[model samples]
Target: MLEKRFKLSANNTTVKTEILAGLTTFMTMAYIIALNPNILTNYGAGGAELWNGVFLATCLSSAVAMFVMAFLANKPFCLAPGMGLNSFMAIVIGQLVATTGMGYVQSFQSMLCIILIEGVVFLILSLLNVREKIVDAIPLGIRLGISPAIGLMLLNIGFGSNVYIADSNFNQFFVMKDFFGALTASHARDVMTDAYPVMVLSAITMFVGLFVIVVLASKGVKGAVIIGMLAASVLYWVCDAVFLGSNPFASLATASFVPAFGDMASTTLFKFNFAGLAQMGWFTAVTLVITFCIIDMFDTIGTLVGTASRAGMVDREGNMPNMKEALLSDSVGTIVGSCTGTSTVTTFIESASGVEAGGRTGLTALTCGIAFLLCIFLAPIAAIIPAAATSAALIYVGVLMMTGLKKVNFDDLSVCVPVTIMLIGMPISGSIGHGIGLAMISYTIIKVFTGKAKEVSGLTYVISVLFLIKFFLAV
Candidate 1:
């Protein structure tokens, strides 16, 4: 049935096998149920209520994409709010808000509008088959560097969430001696468990999960990610009972079926007030939008390519099978995410976790999508996974993403300089789009000034010009 839908050749694997693989893939990525809401709520959309809405939207969008990819396109991939988009939402959009004096809500709405426009543009480009032109226009090295750069940026954000970097107004830096000192000291024992226990248990969950995957992989066990996640959940439960003196598992075991859409109903959607956008001016908006779209497109492409490559899902052409369809679905996913109340829809590098676990087809994406769909009923259970838990996973994912740096063409100044700019600028500027724009501008400058002018294209020059105007305003 799936083979027919995705136009797969006969001799495809049995449906039963595909189902198991897909569900395993889904379980590995289940962490997103908790992670997305946590990140979005930083903008003041909070409570179980707001998170419930986010959970529903993520599940629905991802499911639609996965089903299309699986039964319709035969590609194994997942889609959600991508790492780069999240950074833009948290940092770049925040900057926009701060500079414009618009409240966070208004800024979120604006960013969403921009993302929606970007999706429409992407859809047009894809349908026109001009995507390959845009992609091929960029140097292969730059295109290749995008995935790893995104990985690094994600790692940077994960670190920022887990570990604080304090600029103490002095050259020296130090830890607080303990991360939980403030919590424990302020509450004077109001914490459910002592800070030490919480940290130790969370660490235990993390390390044990890592160990399970590593050991299982060594033994050729399929579904290592699922095993690892289950192991971590069990450990978390045990530690909760032993140290926290309460079994959180029981409370979390209840089914979750509530959709959080009502909470967001009062919020604006699809209503793009051109007034503020007009104030920014068409040139500026176009420039910013172009920069955002290019970076996001490349960043998402790299993620899809890299994870697919790792999964052996790439064809002889180095393209993921059904690549066009995946991109189409992802483009639409971004638009829906924006309309539903979030940042740009992007491919998560963490999906690599699922790939690493032996998910080889769209079934993986389908499984994840279904799990997300079911998450609407399991919201409370999803919430119990804890920030520290997914924080560890994201940091681990970030570390994995940085491994791509080894594959970079370090000897080529053209590649090395731009890639390094992305590596540093993403963390420093706190925005992947900013880092990419700077790198493109720098790349153009190098190529142009070095008399290698023929290597640069008119579009490259156009983007560079636009980037300069945007970056100056942004700075």
Candidate 2:
């Protein structure tokens, strides 16, 4: 039954291979289980109750989304509350709390309302095939560039040096001179001396693991990324135990091994603030909803296409099988995630790990979903894996994603120019939307100047202008 349903043999894969691939993918991306709540809890100001609620929501929503992708889409993909989206939600909540004089809880609830609205909008778009049309509207040049641009973005994130300074008003890039100066003055000394031993050791650990993974993968070692991450985590734990005398299992003792079901079921479950939404003003609410929808839409499209390309799931014409089902699953995940008290959930690029590991069936997604469900009881253990370990996986994946650059056509300046701009802008701007917007605007301008404006689609022009208004005019 499983063979007929998933077509495992047709894809040249076995159930054992699919299970291994799924486990490998889960190990690489499991850090999100702890990291999501850490980001959403706003440094504990949301209190233990809210923190626990978000943590449970992250796990449950992710599991549900993966299952949907497995059964409906029959693809080895996973979904989670996206990293950039969650950070944006945090910034928006902070703004509302400060400007409207609303408490943190109220502001958070208002943010949830925006996410819910965005999710519903996504559902409508997906059902009507509007999202797929938008994807089709994007020029082949830009579509090809999107993957490499996302690769650069992931690389920047993995390095942990792309700094964005957040103030009371908004987040902005740190001054380049000041940022470089600080890197040289403090970071240089900290790496050489005992002043920040942990920082130095963390860097070393990450690089060593990355090197190991790269070498092993080159030799066709199966699960090399997961093995390297686990090894690096063990090294970090040993260092902490010896140097800092910290108890690795202290959190487990404090929180207990059982899932916090009672707290999760009561607090922040389906807690939308429609009245608070009205208080935020219709304009602000609408703007927030649009922003969420745009970011989530492009991010999902880029990731799905890029990862599918890597997995050999896309045909020569760039059409992916069961793409509508895959897209609908993403939409459903966002709606489920929002109602459960989190940010917009979308398809994760980390699913590429499973693809790399020879995952070719929905059974892989099912295995990953089961792993996320198990995390509800193993949260404490999951929390202990340091960022350094997973950073290696991200960097490795980024390296793999750069293969998309081979498909780009550099013979024409109009195509090459936008692709180049997008490739550089993504990492520097720290936004996939910003990079894509720049590419579109540049493409349109170049086409118009070169007497080929008709080459661009109508929807492309409309989206470019919209992005310009949003990013530059702050509308």
Candidate 3:
């Protein structure tokens, strides 16, 4: 039954088939159970119980969000805790605390409050049609560049599952630390001495999975990526259990449809540090909320628009009708995530993978959503998913996301400069808004200086001026 269901394609899929496809989408995204917890813990906010709560909250919020996006919004996209925003909440907020002497929990509460406010703000803008207008205000070149940059950012984080960070003079990165960590740590030593046997195993899983997909796809295989990866992961586990006498990593393996009650009931939600927000002042809260709202809006819209374009989900009007639902559902997810004791819940660009794998309609999202709900009980088994294994998927998706670059007009300096700035700024600046803001400011300067200012939108000019003032004058 599973195989038959998995063998359906988005282009030819019925509602039933799309639902089945969504299940595979859920499996592919299941890593978030661990990933979200790990990221949020950096803020002094998580433990096993916290992780459980986050998993539950994430599941519930996402399920609700997806339902809206799927059944309510009627769009074929999936929503989850966004990748980049969590990092900001985890790391950037930590910095804010250090500089401000705010308690971590208090700061966390403040941030959550900020997120809630951002959601409300987004809801208002969306309703007023202001959000869409702002999005339209962005330059075509800079707008075109955001998607691939997001993909790159996602690919970078995805690589971390395999590579550990180490201190370095040159803004330390993955390479050197991974090299040394392999020799020093016992587990690293064990994996390395064994020539990354698990990684090798995961590689095989990925290879075999890709092969199956390619072959099945040729034979009209639907859900090829999902079927291939699952088969490979299972094979990887079986080999480990048989040869090693146990699968140490099996605990973290992604599972489909196993709901976790314990995680949900105990999850920390609505536990706001009103006192903390007070200390930060209404100004800070408002600033943070504005920042978050702007970032989340661009981030979510970019993901949805890019994903929809790829999946051919765009309408004849060049607009996806249910985007309003996607935005609303995402805001609700953020509120739920805060109440549940985790990072902000936003749409994931990674859902594009499921769409590419024959996911269309709400069925695919529903399947993925159901799979996420099931993951709460499977927490203990998450270790089974190797970083290297997931990295392959990330890299694959990155390759796909990069395809958006074809739309950029490199020949036009007006377009090329801003696009180039965005590409460089996102990863280096470590903030999507920074990358985009710089691009906008630079684009505005270049166009105005070049006498092509008339082509830019009035709002774009106003926003670009604000970016300059906020970044230079205010900061």
Candidate 4:
């Protein structure tokens, strides 16, 4: 039945391979299960109950979306409430509270209303195939650049922001900025204080696990990525226990075993606050919705195109098959998120890790979705997987995606300039959409200035202009 449903043999995969790939994808992205609630609830400022609500919502909504991806599109991509989008929603909620003196919970509910409307709008556009057409409007050069740009974004996440540590003084540190950037061990120790040892452990684990994955993959190991992550997790646990004298599983001590359905029901379940939105004014509501929509649309498109390219899933023109179905899955997930209480759900770039691990069919996504559902009861166990281990997978996959850059025609300045800008913009801005936007604007400006205006499509010009407004117009 699994073979028939997923056509596993047709995709040159076995059930074992797909299952391994699925678990690989889930482990790499599982951080969002905890991190999303923390960010959206402002580190528990919105209340611990609200945090628990978002936690269950994250798992439930992500599982729903991934299941849709499996059955509707037969794609192996995982979906979750996006990282940057959640931060943006928190910012929007803060602005709402400041503007109208509304309570934080009221402001958050109003934001959920906006997300619901955005999902409905996307669903309508997707049904009309308008979103697919928008994706088609992007120039082929820009499309090709998207994969490499996303690769850079992954690298940024792996080395820069993947492991965050707050010291006794509440001083923050990252792998690249503090550990690698520090001039010396003493300097890092001086600056980071007590957090330096943990930082060192993380760096060692990341590089060593990355090496394990690389070596295993070179030898044609079937489950190299997952194996490497497990190896890394064990190593981190040992190091924490032996060196740091801390229990790696200590978090499990106070962890709640059951899903907090009651908290979810009282806090975010069906909690749309349209009246609060109206108080914020129609224009503000519309603009906020548009902002979320635009960011989410390109982010999804970029991840799909980029990861698909790495997986050899795209046509020569750089478009994926069944894009409409894949997009519909995302829109539906966003709707589920708003209803259950969270931010916009989109395709995670971490899906590339699964692709590299040999996932090729819906079964892989099915496995991932099932894992997310289990996280509701087993979140503590999932949390034990070290952040460094996932960073290893991300860094490895990022390196794999950069191999797509070989397809780019660097001799053409139109391709080189835009691609160049995108390569930098993605890592710097931490947004695949923003990188694509900068590349589009640069590509348009270069063509027009070079007396090749006729080559730029009308839709391309419109998209470029919209990005301009987004960057400069400031709402």
* Candidate 4 local lDDT, 196-293, one digit each (tens): 99999999999999999999999999999999999999999999999999999999999889888999999999999988999999998988888898
Give stretches of model 3 more than 4 Å off. 1-12, 43-49, 92-107, 145-195, 203-208, 242-267, 315-318, 381-383, 427-435, 466-475
Range of the 10 consecutive residues with the lowest summed lDDT in candidate 4: 177-186
TM-score winner? 4
Q: lDDT of model 2 at residue 157?
A: 70
lDDT of each: 0.63, 0.79, 0.65, 0.92
For residues 1-475, what per-residue lDDT tens digits would candidate 1 score against the true structure?
Answer: 6666533344254455455556555554566666676676563454555555555666666766666666655666777776545655566556766688776556656666677788889878777767655544556566556657766665654444442322223222111223334444444223322344455566556666766766776797765556666777777877789878977767655554556567666554454545566555577567667766766776566567666655556554445556677677777777777667666676655566555555566676677777777777775665565433444445555566667666678898987898889778766765555666677888889998898989899888876776687667651
The regions of model 1 sitting more than 4 angstroms off are: 3-55, 71-73, 83-112, 146-194, 250-256, 260-295, 312-321, 386-407, 423-439
Q: Which pairs clash (backbone N, Cα, C closer than 3 Å) in model 2?
A: none
Candidate 4: which stretches are off by over 4 Å? none
lDDT order of candidates, top first:
4, 2, 3, 1
TM-score of 4: 0.99
Flag the better candidate by lDDT, 1 or 4. 4
lDDT value, candidate 2, whole model: 0.79
Q: What would the TM-scores of all predictions be? A: 0.75, 0.90, 0.80, 0.99
For model 1, name the residue pairs that clash: 53-260, 76-361, 82-346, 256-377, 256-378, 257-377
